[model samples]
Target chain A: MGGAAPAAGAPLVGANSSGGSLKALDGRVRILATAAFALATVSFSHFGPLLIALGGAMLVARLVELPILKTLRRIIAMDMFIAFMILMLPFTTLGEPLFFVFGFPASRQGLVEAALIGLKANAIVLMAMALLSSFEPVELARAMGRLGVPERLVHLVLFNIRYIDLLYRELHRLRTAMRARAFRANASWHACVSMGYLIGMMLIRALERSERILQAMKCRGFTGRLYLDGEERIQRLDLVFAAAFAAFVGALTLWEILSVAAL
Target chain B: MHIVDGALTLPVIAVGSAITVAGIGLGLRQMPPEKIPAAGVLSATFFCASLVHMSIGPSSVHLIVNGLCGIVLGWAAFPALFVALLLQAIFFGFGGLTVIGVNTANIAVPAVIVYYLCRRGVVRSSPQVAAIWGAVGGALAIALTTGCVALALSFSGDEFIPAAKLVFFAHIPVMAIEAVLTAAAVYLIRRVKPELLDAFSAASPDLQPVLAAAPEASLRSTQS
Candidate 1:
């Protein structure tokens, strides 16, 4: 765990399959349908619904032919904080004690709750990785814009994505330089101060550059709008795929509801 | 500090989203046409801040610096952080799209609070005073953020109280590291480029935006 690269903190998109372009009919459909399913998964809390959703989400991932294990690892790694908290529940939560781990009581209810969080988080993340990873960030932003999200919000997202990678690379280089200069930053006040100075320099540079970037944009006649060609309509294939995805999610949701009613 | 989907209840989601929308609205209003570029860049800075890991013991953790963002960007931290969260969801699957509202509010709201609580001293003349205030703001921001995260977690039910406690405890070290980092950063900026401390100081009567990176704002921030 200590050896794991700190890159997961920002987590760029290279872990994803870059599966396909969302310009394709299926890509758009996948985005639309998976988004709905993701929301549905969020609203759901039960273990059974979540387990079913996890299977369904995995199936969607398979449909896209995504690299499954890699994406799963990335998901778990990114969510380690939440995972850590959930893992603690088994020891901390009071219920019928099933066993002991390190002399702490592990309970049945706690184990079930932990499983629910794990499955729920994995299902949502898998669906996201499979469907959303198909498009580049710019393409995804455009698709989101076309999907009726506010243009301001869309542009904000696009602009940030536009700069995140370049800035991250700069940060990596700067850190390397610091390390070269014998900046170890190892659990000390001096370490924090060194890192803080580094961040301050980075922020100051970015602040100065913003003015020039704006002027360059103005010179290029970049009005407040980001205009891109080929905002395509939803094709028949997209509709069919969207319908199928909807049906799968709907069926599961209905089953969960009915089962709850029965209970 | 990012929460995944299915981790929050409906009322929590609803209230969190509503407050987030309002915050962004305020942020947009604060960001003038000329300032959007600066906001964009600052947004990117905050976005990338997470990737900058300060080594500790055998491992490392990235800086959240929402407190620093708020100190510098004020309400603009709203759209700044919102964009970052959205891109992370899209590009990296770090957090889910459904939870964007809750996540943004959780991070940015505390940032805005710190802005009110600490931005003045950050731009103050005395570096020690500025650093002290920065440290307070930075450490307090994480505590507040953890509290907000816990609040959102508990909104689903009482079952999440333990998880909330776990989150708060886990972040104590981060909070201290952040305090020192923020204090150091505030002091350095105050020493190196004073204008930047007031570049977005809309509330400060003594200073105005030097959007062009001209030396005049620096002169005034220094003199005043």
Candidate 2:
């Protein structure tokens, strides 16, 4: 488990450095900023404001020293998933024809709509990655609890964080055993059944592990309550971040309002 | 199969958030304090399970296994799956923050539905028969989830209807894969640890004995 590397899609916080101002902010502030940014970005429907939101997200990404090439690659992969919708839009949507693809007319309106969605999706994703991904899962859960999230939900989140890495290592070990058995995945029923049994084994093991964990907690006099780490007061850095973020969002909102009024 | 932010309309996002909050509330109410450790660890297992990629032809797809989650965790699946999605959004950026609510509703609602529909057969029937019900529940959950995704998409706009339809059709293979996996998992649980299923059905105090065994008398004996 200690040797397990981060999954491909799951990027770690500040992989190149241990300390940064962005990582020092309170988890609560980061969560609220990401929420506000996403909401504001999604509310845009036009190209002008949407592109600006994307640019703003890029600025934040740079400020946080995000890996530029990696972030672009991730966003492009996301676009591929939605490419079908974007491609179909020009054909299905009725409006002024931009050009003819084969025998079909591609509408300008559909093109604009696709671009709008692409921009909004990219901006929101970048903003979230920039802000919330910096904090550890436990820290985020603690903040969520402080933010009035239900205690049970917070506990569930913490439990997930504690065990995800352990189980992931278990999965790796099981797969290694499978590899040693000369088993390979292919498009066959035998393979499916093998994988199924593998997962079945995983579930059984996880249940037994949980049983032991519950026993251990009971031994320690755990009484349905967990005392989280020390009280997280709003530090000076947090207040500064909040002010800067508010100003950025305020600028975006002003731009959006101006664009709408002009239209 | 998460729908990223900016794709959904305001109304869809708002309605999805409301429903998800209510669902989590119901799930939390059903879960007692004693179940928290079990629920947490099981949900963590599910989160890890989802990271496993299965090969199909030349492409690979990760497992969504919400059906198996529903059968095991029942109503608790809502909060469990929601936490998983929230983590994915935060750590992986696979789905955006705003759409987490919608994604949770789309995934977890079907899980709860399958729980209600198949939990009885899963708990009472023979292992072989139970596997069949598990397969049905797995397929039904995915089918319903895709349907929900489609509805959410189309409700957002007429333009999204095509994309929504495609989403459902694209997941047809996933349904079959999940069905096979769920059947086998259910069969194993029934054989290896049938008591796990009994937790939801009976008020059996399985933890009470463990707690009783933890007092200083046994602790001191073990230390010696």
What is each candidate's DockQ, to 2 decimals? 0.44, 0.46
Residue pairs in steric clash, candidate 2?
none
Summarize candidate 2's per-residue lDDT along B1-224 as a digit string, tens digits: 78888788999999999989988876776555666778888888888878877778787777898998888877778899999988876666677678888999998999988887988898899999999999999899999999999999899889888888988998898899889888888898898888776544232223344533343444344435
For residue A80, model 2's alpha carbon misses the true position, in angstroms, by 2.4
Query: Model 1, A1-103: lDDT tens per residue?
Result: 2223436544453335545433364445656776788777776657777888888877767766677676767776866857776777787677999999888
The 10 consecutive residues of candidate 1 chain A with the worst lDDT sum are: A1-10
Which parts of model 2 have CA positions greater than 4 angstroms off? A1-19, A228-230, B200-224
Model 1's TM-score against the true structure: 0.88
Report i-RMS for every model. Answer: 3.9, 4.1
| TM-score per model over all chains | 0.88, 0.90
Span of ten consecutive residues with least summed lDDT in model 1 chain B: B204-213
